[model samples]
Target: MVVALARKKIYEEIADIILSEIKSGKLKPGDKLPAITKMAESYQVSQASIREALNSLKVLDVIHVKHGQGSFINEQMPLGFEQNFEIITKADIANLLDLRKIIEVGCVRAACEKAEAHHHERMAEALGKMWTAVENNELGEQADYDFHMAIAVSTGNPLLANLLEDVSETMIRTMKETRRIWLYETEKSIQKIYDEHKLIFEAIKNEDAEAAAKSMYDHLKGVEDVLLTNY
Candidate 1:
């Protein structure tokens, strides 16, 4: 007897179609994708699903959105980048967090060793924005992700930065989950996150690799605990 595969969600199906088009050279680099309405009509899916599919492409760096323009394929995107983003799953949040811990903790350590004054300044700025957002009762998810990306960029490793960027969708999901948990379940949890980020930044600023890695690990562990326990 043969087992049937699970049906793909409409958005996922759209995403796969777009990916296949790109891989087949039907959508070349620097080419702007068709409008959402057009794509929806073509694929016989809702515009919302087409939008989601385009967002997934953005997450994978297969395309970049330009406001007032349209989504254009990344000129420098590597071949087969879509393969890296094919395995989207709701149940993979925990696994994504685990992978994040591995990659980001390593990035923190490397940042401590290799980061320059400008890199430290960038992280500090992102940290400041995060604090401001928390004070304003906003999620500050973008700043949070930027702070982490700064650490990765500080490593001066394009490959590492690309690796982290490739997982942008999952990272954003994890960040939103972190904020949601803190906003609803844990009181004053934003303060705790602020303090953790401060510690991580300071360790990197002081060029303490072990401390940076430990601080990053602890920060991620706290988020992981919240996710695993509540989610």
Candidate 2:
């Protein structure tokens, strides 16, 4: 008797197939991928699913996309990154969120008192980038992280900033997963998350420490709730 494999999302399955090809040396580095339409036909999935898989691979730096050209495998793949991506469990995400809440909530509260003009400007810039990315139908994970990082920097505590920076990679991965899930769930979900960020920024700008803390907690809690429930 053989045990059946666990079911994965269609896009994830497609991504895994592509990664296997790469690992097996069938898809060499810097080699162009087949056209999305062709890959869709080959896999018997929609073109949209192929696109999603390609985008996920791109995020992992396994592939690089050139505008108006095509996607190609990265010349130098990050060692062990795929293993890291595959092993991230819900429990890991939950713990990451818990850590974020503890650090970020405190950081925002301190930012309300210590933040300067430059820090606010950086936060605003990050927010602008996030809005633009959303409008362009891209995941603005970097911008989202930048916004929180700005809060951390504004706290006048180098230790707090260092701690956040140390976990930046994991945070980016989780953010990508969270945003991907939101995009798949509803068109409005990403916008709601952006709104939550805006609320937190507003509280910080107004120097309302209590409100800042509450907004940050609520935003992260909302994320935790969605991720835990869905994944």
Candidate 3:
């Protein structure tokens, strides 16, 4: 009964211990985790407890469990989540965007190549909503994110979809900050963003990798330009 009541917390503590190992490179990706019995012994916990912990990690896209083979660490984080106990701050959002760009440009190309009619439909729908939000003269952070997430879904990779959850909060905040600070000075900036998104949507629908990548890059560059011009 005590163990049952403490189950969730125990899972988190055990996961933290293993997650620490993974972050330190002590347990590199593809390195098989210890068997349940060994991990139980090492952690001084029951096998059932260890299993519960592992299951939680699996749901977080943190581990791979194979039939007959032991579980193994996944390479890098699923989307962009997960770090060791390493402290990250609000100031780190810029660096996070850079990292996202580095990894996601490749995904853009892949998605462009494999895009389907339905994918274009999704992006188009989101793009329309974004334009509506733009004309409504307010921040359209959710719509903006939805457009990009549509592209991610087009990649046919659920892992990528799960990975990008709400990562735009920082970007959204920065945009709002920049927007408010420069509302008077930066004329027609929001319209420009909508136009850039249109170009990106068209490129992806056409399955043009170079065009799609370039268009998306240009959109991000426009946002960076706002940062420079306003700040």
Ordered list by TM-score, greatest first:
2, 1, 3
Q: How big is the positional error of residue 161 in model 1, measured in Å on the Cα after superposition?
A: 0.8
Decoy 2 TM-score against native: 0.68
Model 3 per-residue lDDT tens digits across residues 1-231: 355453436656898888878878788888899999999999898998788778656545577666578788877664555643322232344565565576566667878888788888888888888788777887666677788788888889877766666465555545554444334344555767778889887777677889988887766766655554433
Regions of candidate 2 where Cα sits further than 4 Å from its true position: 1-22, 25-86
Tell me the lDDT of model 1 at 88.
44
Two-way TM-score contest, 1 vs 2, winner: 2
Question: How many residue pairs clash in all the candidates, one count each?
Answer: 0, 0, 1
lDDT against the true structure, each candidate: 0.80, 0.85, 0.69
lDDT digits (tens) for residues 197-231 of candidate 1: 99999999888989988999999999888766654
Alpha-carbon TM-score of each model against the true structure: 0.63, 0.68, 0.55
After superposing all C-alphas onto the true structure, candidate 2 shows an RMSD in angstroms of: 8.1
* Winner on TM-score (2 vs 3): 2
lDDT of 3 at 117: 88
Candidate 3 least-lDDT 10 residues: 84-93
Best by lDDT: 2
For candidate 2, the per-residue lDDT at 112 reads 95
On TM-score, the stronger of 1 and 3 is 1
